[model samples]
Target: MPERVVPGRPDGLITLGAADALWVDLTAGSAVPTAFGAFTRSPARARAGYVLLGGRAVTTVRASGGRWSVSVGEVRRAAAELNAVGTDPQDLVRIGPFHGAPWQEADEETVLCWRRRIAGGLWEPGRPQRAARRDLDRPYHLAGIDWRQMLVERTRDGTQRTWWLPRAVVRLLDAAEHAEAQWLQASQTHQAGAAVTGPPSHPRRAARDAGGRQATDPEGPAASLRPYNGELKGQLYSVLSRKPGTSRGVAGWACAVCRTAPAAVLDHCHEHGYVRAPVCQSCNTLERPDHLYSNDIRVANRYTRLFHTDTDDWLRHWHRCPGCRARTTLPLPHLAAWTAHTACRSLRPTHRAPRGRTPCGVLRVSWTGSQNTPRSCLLTVTVDCCPSGEHRLLAQVPYREAVERFRVWLAETAPAVAAAAGPDRLDGLPTEPRPVVADTSGEGLALF
Candidate 1:
């Protein structure tokens, strides 16, 4: 039988230029479990036999804000590397110079294509070099390499999307693929003998609880004991656990907003804890100011409608005022403006009307009750009016009792409101301004 392609070593950071050894990715190109070779190259002479893929030398310019930008050549070098791994490598000379200014600006086609290469919205520095280890029983190898290398394709719009992989990784990945095929064939033909891959006994089944149930320790050694699946659920789980707005999630296959660029990162509502959709960096960055600072409810709603899979809850609640029958926006939870909408106090003054309008209305809800007094929750509704003391008291009652009464009031008042209050009609509302993001990089900007 051919030599079994065993795991190289316990994976950790190893200096590439130092000692020579085999660095094998047990899962091939699937997940981030590439292991540093456990054993050094057998002989010093063997070092000469292996080829090393050299990285492009990157030159960085740090702006006054400490943001980094790379030369135009670096972008071309990345494009070249990505094309080299594709089925049809396009000519680097044929690809035109980037159109945007400062070399960091994101366009629809380029940003979308750029997001596919990056795991999150932002290009993580040194991510292309590091492979976090994932435990697997069988030493399975698949075709192609990991996210370290990417393939490039030309879009119909004449823009390019590409990801780069090193030649060294490509060679090792190809070798590991061959090794796996050989091992599988050997195990199939010789069933009577020991299998070529996988441990003698599964590590996850090794430990048991007092009740005779299988014990699991995801934070311990058992974290790495599970079987490998192609879906990358392990990495996704890690990403979901992080704080909101962290550009640590996987890249989207397509941007949900523009639908033109590939989504570069997972966009989320920091205030509402709503995990939105994978979107391009431009779309993701554009969402923040609109949701937080913009006074025009329609503009903010437009973004929410596009990026969020479901906008019914947002629309039905804060999007339209029940009293004034006008569309309005709400502030984040921590902002002082949010107090007007929550019944934490006996009574609070309503928010000043949005710029250039009268006090539209205020709809406040309060669920304040201890475990011993669950029924103490209350809902208070009020609308600010032009004359002081002329304010209308819509409702004040137990939270359970208030819902039915409020619905009755809303039903009666719905017909009299003007037809101009439709949420979808955004012809004359204020437009969101284009925001300039800080350009930061390590080696260089990956999305350029």
Candidate 2:
């Protein structure tokens, strides 16, 4: 006896008698086994047989006898192994107790009936068949499997039947079905010349049809020129061909006020619509129409008076008249008298007047620097005195030179005023005439 290896079960081997068995390697398509040679040569009695190796039916042959009949126990063992390896059930041959009948000889109806009976585990040799629901009799429910798209087909002889899908195989059948239906619908619509609802197929053509030209006109004085006719198109082309600076450039190349940032926009007076000059974006924003009435700008003007004219500058420096509260510009000599009057009026009535004379005049000297440039200063002198008038003087100079000139003026003026008033009149003054120098700490008017 010789042993042959089973196809699926590595531990199982089949024993064959020398005369009854012949080696037939199915994968290589060898000739019919010697055991089935007689049947293959004679067509009249030839019946299709199957060889089960390791429980999986591997090939068909023409043969007869107990030599090919696999026992129930062997069949069960083979099935268990096949199941463990996930073999397809269609690959298996029918298990039978019939006396050496070939599976190919069975009629279609009889084979189908047997298959139905065996598929539901209703057939067990020598054991009573149990009454159980057949697959057709009960609703088919397979875990993770959808049956709606399953397909079935039969072979040419009709003895063997197979399905396109396995019972346990799962797939996204619904999504595939929907996509197929959508494709069919789209094809039908296209054939019928109906418009499809989706993104445009030719975006450039669609944009042209939807008036894209009007939205993309280049901003310029001649931007209004449109190609309504050939003549207009020619004119527009000529205008566009000119050099860049010919029409768009401004005469002045820097902001009028700051004079730092490049002049990039043509600013115009909002009220009159007259071109002011080329100015940077920041300077133009400050002069917007809304800022004319803004309280913040008003407050800012109260301090610097830059928004208004030079007359506001004069009034701010004078501090107004004490008796009439009128805004006036006076010479530097009249400032002492104006200050004295204002200070005398401001004194509280409840407090007794100074026992001796008190000086009521005040003089202030300050300087402003140009924020855009270093070492630049605008020096201003303001004097406030009683019963005469107020005066202010302004000069532009270098920062360090301004400070030096102010220090020199303070040293000279303080003694001259005191000497002119004399010791007798000093008692009527608030204090001896003293010049005050404005300090950088922003504490206004400190007397020196």
Candidate 3:
């Protein structure tokens, strides 16, 4: 064994350093789990090995205002040591930067090629040095190895998308925060549900205070164990225990995406245990802003067709998250997937050209229970509104289109109202909505 000495800190947990072992304690918000009740030391070590060797850490969790604050600073020390490249063969792995590799420069290729290549995503054909950024998209979870991942990509269709996430995401996420985000993401997956890698026998929530309970504790009650956070535990059961997103006992209010309230987020820590955060259901449960395949590693190209084999394909994904390196399955179908549904749901993520006056009178109204139907109307009426909280709404009212349609329909169906209407009354209303592609294929079916 490599010098089994604990660099002792106040936290009693010793870190075995390169030179020698020293007794040192950690600071208040140290990333190292002191005594996490949810996991065995063996798995944790394997995980830790993978993380430490990465040369980075999630310094900021999503809830921590997306800031990377918690690091042992060992990363800097590690960098300095590894910066020399070929220092000590025993402690250092040669991360041969593939300054020259035959990577795809085409806009059409995706990371899936690495899945079928002779070198695999990790290795080179002839004593490959370190892998290139365009080299990996699969979940290469082993520690102490050189791995490459892409953070963005340009699709062949002349559209650009991000497969890898931002670096700010790192150093910002600790294990628990990352785990919760992943857990919340796994729940909202579409046709090919997301997968959880290296599941603990009975994963439990992280304990916040001394009063928090632990099932794994020798003296604690294990039979009736529940998640550490009470509200989230209740909500997780409500949304996940039964069919996903269905109306269950908890009103699916806990279903972060569907419910209007910021829902509880779930994850695990190295030493602390599972962590659940109170976040917008949409951000937490619906479209995973965190789950992405970057420009270099085109994950979408890989899984578009991986499940035709006799083997249980869905159960065998190996793509690791660039954020926490948490192993995850295919991108979950968002509760509001399908281009039309997605666009209708979040105007923030959607981009549409301004509507122009069209021959067909179209009224795209997003209505809520509180609002009554217009006293009189005409033309084409389309509404893609879903019900939510009583009032506290964050929706975008179709400012221009709705107004134009109202007036046009009034002119045809209720000309009296059109004549009575004043320009001041519809100041924000445009003269017309731009003509859209006759193709409704990209749009959502009209919803109530």
TM-score to true structure, per model = 0.22, 0.15, 0.19
**Candidate models: Cα lDDT each:** 0.29, 0.27, 0.24
| TM-score between model 1 and native | 0.22
Query: Residue 78 lDDT in model 1?
Result: 28
Please provide, for model 2 over 1-448, each residue's C-alpha lDDT reduced to its tens digit, 9 standing for 90 to 100. 4344456532232323211133222211311111222112221111223222221222222113423222223333333433343323232221222233222221221112222323333333454322223443332221111122232333323443322332122112111122222223333554454345654322111122342211111121112222111111112212333548522333224344445343334443221122334444334333221111111111111222222233232222222111111112121212221222222223312222459554333433333432123265443434334324433322223434433443343334343322322223222222222222323221111110
**Highest-TM-score candidate:** 1
**Candidate 1 residue-wise lDDT, 235-334, digit = tens:** 2323564756443223323445454443445543332222345554444433332111121111222332322343333323232322112222222211
Query: Residue 68's C-alpha lDDT in candidate 2?
Result: 28
Model 3 CA deviation exceeding 4 Å by range:
1-139, 142-159, 164-277, 280-448
Candidate 1 segments whose C-alpha is farther than 4 A from its true place: 1-276, 279-374, 384-389, 397-448
Q: How would you encode candidate 3's per-residue C-alpha lDDT over 24-134 as one tens digit per residue? A: 122112221121211112212212211222222111111123211112344333334223332211111111122333222111111112112313444445753333455
What lDDT, from 0 to 1, does candidate 1 have?
0.29
lDDT of 1 at 123: 29
Error of 3 at 293 (Å): 21
